[model samples]
Target: MVRIAIDAMGGDLGPRATVRGTVEALAANAELQVRLYGPREALESEFSRLPKRLGADAERLDIVHASSVIAQDMKPSSALRARRDSSLSMMLDEVASGQAAAGVSAGNTGALMALSRRALGTVAGIPRPAISTAVPTQQGGRCYMLDMGANIDASAQRLVEFALMGEVMARRVDGLARPRIALLNVGVEATKGTASVRHADALLKEMANINYVGFVEGDGLFSGTADVVVCDGFVGNIVLKASEGLARMLIERVQATFAAHWGSRVVSLLARPALLRLRRQLDPVRYNGASLLGLSGIVVKSHGRADALGFACAIARAVQEVRIDLPRHLEHELGQRAATAPVALDRRGSGVSPCAKTDDFNS
Candidate 1:
């Protein structure tokens, strides 16, 4: 069984929603073992009420007491440094100690990233860790988008590395072998966007590691043009928020329209199945969280406003990631690429450059 350490004190709803979610996830997947980390008395009190509210499977749950709790408004680094006994810190400690396969939190993202880097470290040769999110496409497929908010500013080389990592994750986690990758740009043309996008485009086109399907505009994100989309965190965050906002708006509009009158109520009854299907497709809860990749240990971050179902889904995702040995697979792939790729040269002519010697060698 894959063990997941959860930050029971992090989210807005506190232990109630988180504990409820834990119960729900346990019920859904019997093989999952959750170690709830938070204030001892609070968690125990909540657990006591779960048997009557959620059921007797509460026995399967484990609790690790954390005296201190980090607030959402607190600075991530300060919170982590000052409150060493916070729930998030304790959860990460479990992951680092190998007591838990992964850590799941609906806590402050900045704190999570800082704590993760400090605790687990990053994969070799990776400049910054990235947050990879799975976005549902119109073709009933899911496209993986990376650098969601990990690194707001990135270089062309960083984007290229993110693409490679994203491709590996898409295949390993989503079971998509040879997933098509596209560089997210303003236009579909290779010449589109600023210098960063252009440089990334050139590098992607030349890289033989993954399937580089050229450029894709923002509009094509939901159209399923590519299985993996790469971009800097700034742009990726915008795309993520836009998609979320649109989904929420559509759902709200449908709900308001259906409540207008008797005629619409009849129409709503007939369309309930279709609406539910649509909700499930775009539901943030279903894909409730994203993984912070390139870190040595797994860290899954969920929405701050996520309810019990969303938290449950995040737990499930963490289990899947651990079961698949995500970090080990990434390390192997990245190490292999680093080994095969030519080493970087200094400004002085210490050795023959691969770019310059290629034609001469072929001749």
Candidate 2:
């Protein structure tokens, strides 16, 4: 059985959402075993309300007591120093110790990132992990976007790293053999973006291993123009948040319009199936898991506010990663590239050129 460690006390909803989500995942996947970490009493109380189906599935769950919980607004450094016994940290410890195949947390993103790196370490040559998730496109396809709030200021070399990692995600998760990579910039022109982006673009163009497709503007993200889009955490976070907010808004507006009058309500009934399909497709909760890529082990970050269903989706992502042994594939790819064409670096042995530090984007 594939065992997954969960941070039951990490999210805004605490054990209520996480325990239920764990039960849901257990019910869905018969081969799954969960090593849930949190206050044993609270977790048991939450599990006390489960139906027979979940109760049966709970047989595979093993609750390990964790005294501390990581707060949503907790600083990463403080969480590391003071909350070592936190559910998040304990869950990662299980993964690091080979007690679990992967780890899942609906906790403080910063804390999860920091603790995960500390516990699991990083793939060889990866300075840090990148937050990545698949975002749907207008053509009914999905694109992998990365650096989604991990590093606020990614240097040119970091952007290249995001590209390589994102490319691997697309290939492994989405089964794209030659995932096209792009740099998100103000314009598609070679001269329009900040120095970091331009430098990364030039470097990517020279790498035959990557299918680097020059540049794409924000609009290109949903246009199905690229398979993997790389950007700094600042920009990636904005894009992801904006897209999710817009999708939620659009879905609500459609529902409101349909419920406005009796005639529309009748039409809505006729279109119920289509609307449900659309909602399923557009709901941000459906794609609630963001992978902390470039780590030695698989770690999935669930949205802090995710409900049981959403958190289950995060668990599902972890299960998928485990089934495929994602990190090994990434290590293989990185090794191949390092042997052939290593990333370009300046005299300082960094991805940035002298002008990159002054670039408005990185700054």
Candidate 3:
């Protein structure tokens, strides 16, 4: 069975959402097992309320008692020093101890990244972990983007590392043979971006295995122009949050337009199915999990405000990564690149900085 661990008290809904998601995940996949870490009373209370039909699935579920929880506003440093007994920490402990293949949480993003790095460490030659997730493309495909806010400032070399990791993620998770990689910039020209982007572009062009496809602008993110888009955390985080906001605005406007008049209402009745599909396509909840790529173990962070179904989607993401053995593949890929090109593989740990808290639970 593929065993996964969860911080049941991590999100805004706490055990109310997590326990339900756990039971749902367990019921959906017979080969999956779960280790839920949270207060014993809370977990038991939630589980007891779930349908009796899921009782059979509960056989593979285990609850590990955790005494505390890390608050959403807690700093990563404080959490590391004072919240060792927190559910988030305990969940990562299960993964680090080899009792679980992967871990999932909807807790403080900074805390998760800090604790995970200390507990699981990063893969060799990787300075730090990058937050990555797939976004829907106009072509009905998905494009993977990284540094969604793991590190605020990344060097040219760090951008290169993100590129390599994102390429691997697209290939392994999406089954793309040679994912088209691009550097996110202001314009498609080599001379259009900052010094770091320009430098990284030069370096990527020299790497034969990377399949580098020059630069991609912000508009290109949804244009099906590239499979992997690499950028610093500052730019990437803004792009992600803005894209989500824009999607919500557009969807709401469309719905409002459909309800404006009797004539439109009649058409809306006929077009309901297509509109529902469009909403689902743009729903950020469907893409809830963000992988902490480059870590030695699998770690997925769910949006803190996510509902039960969204949390369940996060759990599913961890299971997929566990089965794929993503870290191993990343390590092997880095090793191969280093053996062939020494300059491109100049890897060194740039030690963790004080993790910054964001409005959303993302780092």
Candidate 4:
């Protein structure tokens, strides 16, 4: 059975949303187990109030008492340092100790990233772990965008590495055989954007390991020009937030338009089902969150405002990631390339560049 450690004290809804989501996930998958980490009394009290169906499944649920809880406003490093027994810390410990295959938290993003890095460690050759997100594309497929907010300022070399990692993830998670990658840029031409983007583009085009499709502009993001989109954290975060806001605004506009006239109301009555379907298709909660790739173990971070259903989806995503052995696949790909090629030196001449070993560079 796959086991997951959940930060029960995290998120706006606290134990209620966490416990409810866990119960929902358990009900959906009987082979799964959840170990809740939080204040013993608080967890127990929440468990007691669960529906009879879930409360009876308590045998499958375990609790780890964490005397302290980190608040959303608390500084990540300070909260992590001051609260040794916080729920997030305890859950990460379980992951590090191999007690759980993954950890899920709807907590402070920075804290989760910091704690995960400290506890789980980064995969070999990965400079910094990236927060990868899945966005529905206009071509009826999903594209994986990486470094959403994990590393605000990444080197051109690091972005190249992120593209490789993102390709591995998209293939493992989405089963893409030849996942095409595009460096997010201001234009489709090879010459575009800042020095970092242009440099990364040059490197990507020459990297034999990835299916580099040159540049993809912001408009192309949803147009499905690429399977994996790589950009610095600052740009990726802005794009993600903007996409989310745009989706929300469209939903609100549709609602307002329907209420403005009686004929529209009648149309809306007929369109309610379709609108709901579209809403589900674009719901941020349905997407929930993304995995923190480049780590030894699976770690999913959800929005702090996520409700029970959203949290449940995040849990389900983690389960799928574990089932696919994402980390192992990445290790195999990186290792195989390393074994077959001459070591490419970095600026410091330490080792081979990540882009040097792959056999798919564009002429």
Candidate 5:
């Protein structure tokens, strides 16, 4: 049985949403166990509200006591230092200490990243963790996008690491054997993007393992041309939010259009099934988890405002990662990539310059 740690008090609804989600996950997957962390009395109040439909299944869940909560606005580094016993901190500690295989939380993004790095450390050969999640594409399939607001200004080398981690996620979680990757840029031309992206692009193309496609613009994000899109956190976050908002707006518009006039209402009734399908296809709740890839252990970040069903999706994602042993796969992939990829230290002895040779790929 795979056990996952959950921060019951992490999100907006605290234990209310988290507990229901855990129950739902336990009902859906028999092999799953959840260790919920939060204030005992508060969590008990939420537990008492669990639906009777999930009776014996509640046995799969256990709540551990935590003393405090971290505020959403707290600085990431400060949150890490201020509260070792916070629900978020304890949840991460469980996964790091081997008590759980993975951890899920809907807490503050900055604090989660800070605490996770402090607890689990980065996977071998990865400099930092990058947030990644699968987004719906135009071709009826989905593609992974990375650096979705973890590090706002990742270096060229860090972007390469994001690409590598994104590839691993696409393979391990999404079941893609050779997920094509693309760098997010202004245009497809080599000279179109910033120097860092151009540099990372050169390195990616040389990797025999990655199916490195050329650059993809903002419009190509959901074009279904690439299986994984890489970018700095700043751009990735904007695109992610914009895409989600746009999907919601589009779905609302469609719904309104169908209900506007008598004739349209009749047509809508005729196409209700397809419209429902479209609504489900564009629902943000369907994609609730954003993985912090490059951590030594699995950590899933659910949307802060997610409810029961959405939180259940995040729990499901954590379960999937644990079942696949994503960390082990990523570590092994890194070892192989690092072995072939040359690493030259900078003058300050700080980082590996993957693009050391101007003709590294062309050579």
Candidate 6:
């Protein structure tokens, strides 16, 4: 059975959401098992109310006591130094110690990233973990984007690393062979983007493992231009959050349109199936899990305030990663590829530097 560790106390709703999500996930996947980490008494209380809800299937679950919880806004350094007993830390420990295949958390983004890096470390070819999530594309395919918020000031070499890592993930997890990878930039022209992007572009074209497809502008994100998009955390995070906000605003506008009058309501009724499809396509809950790629162990982050179903989706994501054994594929495959790749030149056109050192990055 694939075992997952849940940070039951990590999210906004605590075990109320976590336990229910666990039951929902467990019911769906017979091969799945979970270890919920939180305060012992609190977990017990949550379990007491779930007998009818989960029935005897609750036997598939276990609880591990975690006495503390890292605050939602807690700094990563503070969490690492002081919150070892926190549910988040304990969950990571389970993965690090090989007791669990993966860990899921709806905790502080910074804390989770920091703790995951410290506990699981980085896989070969990845010095630091990058936050990666899939976005719907115009071709009805999922496009993977990375460095969502992990490293704000990512270097040109670092961006190259993200591309390599994202490429491996797309192939292994999504089963894409020779996936089209692109750098998120202002324009498609080689001379249009920043120096770092331009430099990374020059590097990617030479990599044997990646099918680098030049640059993709913001509009290209939904235009089926690339299967994997790479960017620095600052740019990627803004793009992701803006897209989410825009989705919500458009949804509200659609509701207002459908509820405006009897005539509009009639149109809505006739278009119900299409509207439902759109809703499902754009539902934030469906895209709830973001992988902390490049880490040695599997870690999926859920929306901090996600409902039970959304959290369950996050749990399901961890299971998928475990089944694929993503880390091993990345380590062995990318590690071998990096060993033979040419050194990437910096803006100064320097051939080698400490930042581009492949030892730690491709370790």
Which candidate comes out best when scored by lDDT? 3
Candidate 5 overall lDDT versus native: 0.80
- TM-score, per-candidate, Cα-based: 0.89, 0.91, 0.94, 0.90, 0.91, 0.91
- Runs of candidate 1 with Cα error greater than 4 angstroms are 51-56, 342-363
* lDDT per residue as tens, model 3, 102-160: 99998888889888887887775687679998888886888888889877777888899
Clashes of each: 0, 0, 0, 5, 0, 2
Candidate 6 local accuracy as lDDT? Answer: 0.81
What would the per-residue lDDT of candidate 6 be over residues 228-301, giving only the tens digit for each residue? 99999888888888888888789778978987988999887887788777875776434468898878899999
Local error of candidate 2 at residue 87 (angstroms): 0.7
- Can you give the lDDT of residue 305 in candidate 4? 68
Clashes of 6: 2
RMSD of 1: 7.9
The whole-model lDDT of each prediction reads 0.78, 0.81, 0.84, 0.78, 0.80, 0.81
**Candidate 2 lDDT, tens digit per residue, 216-281?**
999878889999899998899888888878888998889889989789999888888888888767
lDDT of 5 by residue, 71-177 (tens): 87777756746858899999998998999999999888888887777788767657567888888888687878888887777677788888888888888778888
Lowest summed lDDT across 10 adjacent residues in model 2 is found at 354-363
Please report, as a residue range, the 10-residue window in candidate 6 with the lowest summed lDDT.
354-363
Give the better candidate number (5 or 6) by lDDT: 6
Residue pairs of candidate 1 with colliding backbone atoms:
none
Candidate 3 vs 6: which has more TM-score: 3
